[model samples]
Structure formats: C-alpha cells, structure tokens
Target: MSHTEQAMPRRAGQQGLWVLVAVAVSLALLAGCGDDGPTDLQPDAGTEPEVCGPSDVWCKDQTIDRLDLLTTVSTGEVREEGTTSGEFLTFVDSRAGGLSPTMSYSYLRFTPQGLTPVQIHDQESLGSTDWDLAVRRYTLRVNSGTSGPSCVSVANTPEGTTFASVTAVNAAMEFKTEAWFDTACTLIPDDSGLNGPLTQLGGFWAYTSCVQMTGRVFVIRLADGRHVKLEVTSYYEPSAQQVCNQTGSVPQPSGSGAIRIKWAFLP
Candidate 1:
C-alpha cells in the first residue's frame, strides 16, 4: 500500500471523534440560527470523505510469508560447533562500503540449516521474499515494514539469558516489526553508531563513541512462525591485532562493520 494510504484505523481515535462532535454542534447551531441558510452541511452526494493527514497514517497489513518463496540452495555447513546445540556462523563484511548515503545493504536469508547470502540489493529487496535480514554497517532491517514485504519480526530475550537457555518461543512474547518512524512520522535515531533509526533486531549493539555488543539475545520469529535465537558475537574482525577494551574503545579502530552472529533454530 502507498505510505499515505496505509490502513491506520488506530490513528482515527479521540481526535477524529471530537472533530465530528464539533462539526455536529456547529451544524446544530446553524440550523437554529435561520431558515434562510442553505442546508447541505455535508459533502456533495458523490464526494469522498476527507483524507487523513500524514500523522494519521499507519501500516498494519499482514506481511508476505517468505517460506512460500524459498528457493532451493546449498546450505552452509554448520560452523563453530559451540557449547549450545545451535550453530554459530559469522558473516564477515556485512559492512558493504563505507558509510556513503548511496551504499547498498548486504542481505542474508536465514533457514533451518544455515544462513545464505542474497544477491539482490537496493529497493528490489523490498519486493523479494528471498531475504530475511538486511545489514548495512551496524543497522539491520527485517523483511517487513518500509524495508520489505515478508513478515520477519523479533522478540528480545530477557537480561542474563544464555543462548542455550532460550529453547522455545514464548507464546506471550511480544514481537516487534521494523518500525522506523514515531507516531508523528519522526525518524528514531540509531544514536550510537549510525544516522538511521534503531530497528528491532538492530538493538543487538550499543554505542559509546565506539561500538560494543549489548550481549542481548533475540528470538527471531520468521514470516512463517519458526523461531531462531540470535546473538551478535562481535562487531570487530577476530583477526585484528588491536583489541579494544570491554567498553569497545580502541585508538585506531579497524573492522568497524565486520559482524559475526551466533544463532540456532529453537524447538
């Protein structure tokens, strides 16, 4: 749907109601004023209702399920064989180019077996269901919202929870879509690392002039309802000689956008 025409019934709240009430009161007063006044207070018979303002618009359409669009591909062999039952795979060079405004995002698809890189980039990714998550530097976007058409969303795990501890998806867990704007259509700041808004899955890391992983684990609920627990392992390249402190402050930072994540499909 067009951004302006999005079905945002939630925005038609007390303000809209009050507008109607005020109009009714004005019409009633006009009716009592004189019989000479022309009667049709409403719009002409064939005329459309007033259009809602930009702030009144919202998007609630159900996302396209990517499971139906899965193309057969060779899955990457499970790597790291970590402490948990889940697989740990690191995606190097998620930072496509330097932070140019025109730089394209690196896209990847998550499957039950492993992660695969998606070739298509730019606006075309929004229409394709082949990809689940798109990364550019530290910022991330799922297949939903202004990002794409699929219904991928995420639920953040509680504090101090290990990846192995989160085995099943909680029925009551709150899932968040890729929301970039406030109710007033303002862009929420990414603050720490980038110029964009902080997305649902992008909360994995925090900034303090230098970037650091928040150690937050998230349960990603794919478009088809399967859950995968994910943790961002590192933002710096493991091979780099200069290591930053626990606070993620380094004198000459290299490998700023190189990202590695640990994830496993939950039962």
Candidate 2:
C-alpha cells in the first residue's frame, strides 16, 4: 500500500475509539429531550381521537406514542390571549385544505388518564410553535378535539407527513400517529433539535392523543424543514375572556410557568 494507505489504519483506529466514547458519554439522549426519565406529570405539554376511527390514524411504516387532554391554553396576556398564551395547545395546520389527506409523521406524550398542562414559551425543552408544530404534525392530529372543538381529519399532500385530522365527538379513544419512508425529508435528518433544514424524508414516525378537523387534502411543505400541511381551516386564537368563559375544560385558563420533563422510549 502507498504511504497514505499505510497511515489509514491508525486514523481508523482513532475513530473507533471516538465511537466508543460517544456511546458512553452520558446516555443523555436515552432520556427525553427535557430531562431523560419519568419525573412528575404536571402538564408540560399535552388527548384523542375519532372520525376515521382513532386506531386508523397512524403511519404504516412508523411507530409513535402520545397523549392529549381535553384542555385549553388561555394566557391572561393580551398578545397571547386565548391562544397558546401561557396555558396549553390544541390545534394543527388550520392554515389552509381538502378532507382526507394522508399523514406523514408525528409523536405525542400525555398523562395516564387525566387533564395535563402545556407550558407556553417553554424555552427549556426547545419549545415554540414551529417546534411544537413539527412534533404535532409528526405525532398527532392537525385539529384535535380533546375538548369540544370539531372538524378533524387528515388532508392530501404532495408528498410527506401531514398530521391526520378527525372529528371530536364524545369518544375517549386511545390513539397514536406514525409515518413511513420519506426521502424529501432527508435534508433534515436530525430535526429533534436544530440539526438541518426542516425537510421531509421518505421515512417518518410519530404518535399523539387525537386530531380534529374536516379537510380532505394535505401538503408536504419544505419550508423551515419538513412540515406537513393539513387541509383544514386556519387556527383561530380565542379571546382570553372567551377562553376563561368556558370552564370545566381545564382548571386554569391563564397561567404561565416553565416546563420540565423526563421520558423514555415506550415499547
């Protein structure tokens, strides 16, 4: 072998050492993004499902787990009012849609069987609408009705993951979201964080509580990485007073707090 080839063995050996080191670092990833194990359920981010049958809402080649409470996010703040102000979130791509679009990917987490909380502007867990949307699209419905909202179903998209939507009736169904092979999302192989362009991939997966909407189309967007466009109406932010007016759905409508989490992959 040439001189360069002769020296390759040492370099390769060093890389092997690095791989081992990385494997033994801290097992941080083994834990969820927030903490890395099961802590206390205080509504950090938080139900289900119906219409096309809750069990039917899933990706064939992907797996996921999620939960949602029939809750609301009503911060007293004027800017964020009845929106994901300081409380919880409960909608998907109510932006623009058809009626029966296929989904892409998604994942969701929830308390065993009770109402949970959602922390707005939850910076610690890389929380944000876009990030939340990403996870929601990949995990749950575009417009879920764990509370009372209606019109939920998946939409048709060009290609990729679009959170399936379903109606809200009085059904308390257990559900999950999933995805399959997607190459378009390749640009963003590691979107759990700020890895690369939020693109769609041929392969995807997710799980969530429930989805509620009435669109029959979907759009796989390449903007800000991989985002699925559900065929539904726009997400309308409710007024603080309006949200507060509706009681029993959740306890506190307008409140702000930080979110801490610890999770592990469910079998």
- Separate clash counts for every candidate: 0, 63
lDDT of 1 by residue, 75-182 (tens): 222234345445766564654545543345666888755676777745556567777777666766777665677777889888788877887888878988677666
Q: What value of lDDT does candidate 1 attain over all alpha carbons?
A: 0.64
TM-scores across all candidates? 0.64, 0.18
lDDT of each: 0.64, 0.27
Error of 2 at 250 (Å): 31
Which candidate number has the best lDDT? 1
What lDDT score goes with residue 106 in model 1?
A: 63
Weakest lDDT window of 10 consecutive positions for candidate 2: 256-265
